[model samples]
Target: MKPIITTERLIIRELQPDDAAGIFRLDSNPAVHEYLGKSPITTIEEAQNAISFIRKQYETNGIGRWAMVLKDTNEFIGWTGLKLINTEEVNGHRNFYDLGYRLVQEHWRKGYGFEAAKACLDYAFSVMKLEKVYANAEKGNTGSNTILQKLQPVHTESFWDEGVETIWFEFQNNKIGS
Candidate 1:
């Protein structure tokens, strides 16, 4: 499949049915879920369902989390991209774009997350012409927090997310160049 965006080390593309196994491997890992509600999916069917849901977002919202693949090996490492959060309010905000990514356990600490995120942000500001984007990380997830910090979001706030304290960041397109 053609990629929506390509970085030096990764390809960002829409999620597909063929990615069910990769999603299963990624979401089924407890380590990968450590910061994401602590609930790992138990079946490939669940993975397929997830793919179906994200795919629908492309049609309805014109954007959604995308599959992140390796450039060297064409491997499905995980997913990364922007998502529209219009259905629910988060940190007193809705109808905004959120940047997110999840990678397999083996791919952790390898900078894939940062690479994919940078590409997505470029797409957000340059192609999407978005004014701002938001991201959040569980307080204990240092790796994710580091990446968000590096992005230099204009605003940061702490909020309770499902009983867990999370740090929310807001990145403005203008602030990036200022």
Candidate 2:
């Protein structure tokens, strides 16, 4: 697989070794990491480690998160793709797929999150033959909830953990490519 997914204004692909600096910039922005439950990464080494880990996920599972690039500028904006997440305790399932995306601060307020995430959802349901995809966002992330609402995912539940509440969303088998 070439690992490239081209959209009208974005390119979704696997992370490359040279992307470490760009990934570092995205990961190191405190504003971007505010709702991410941790501080920004401070080192290129951490970005490199993340790249290796993502690649390993692709190799082992045939699916993983993808780096998103702006088509006009070819600049790394962020990432969006599928991930196997722990849903056993929450949904009574051991292995479940989730759709996720994160963009740098500068890209916020644009439609990039929805664009990239919709593309990933298409890949998951159409290409990967997945029947469902789940997503979660911090309770106060109105932007995220809005984007997910456009997808018509079922609003599962809201739960508080460690002082933060998260809203869960799920898109099931019937709505792909609709």
Each model's lDDT = 0.92, 0.83
- Stretches of candidate 1 off by over 4 Å are none
The candidate maximizing lDDT is 1
**Model 2: per-residue Cα lDDT over 110-175, one tens digit each:** 999998888888888777888888888888888888788888775568876567888888887657
Provide the TM-score for each candidate, comma-separated.
0.97, 0.91
What RMSD does model 1 have?
A: 1.4
Task: For candidate 1, give the lDDT of residue 69.
Answer: 93
| Superposed Cα deviation of residue 146, candidate 1 (Å) | 0.6
Look at candidate 2 and tell me the lDDT of residue 4: 64
* C-alpha lDDT (0 to 100) for residue 154 of candidate 2: 53
Per-residue error (Å), model 1, residue 42: 0.4
Model 2 residue runs over 4 Å out of place are 1-3, 86-93, 174-178
| lDDT score of residue 53 within candidate 2 | 92
Residues 132-178 of candidate 1: C-alpha lDDT, one tens digit per residue? 99999999999999988888888899999889999999998856521
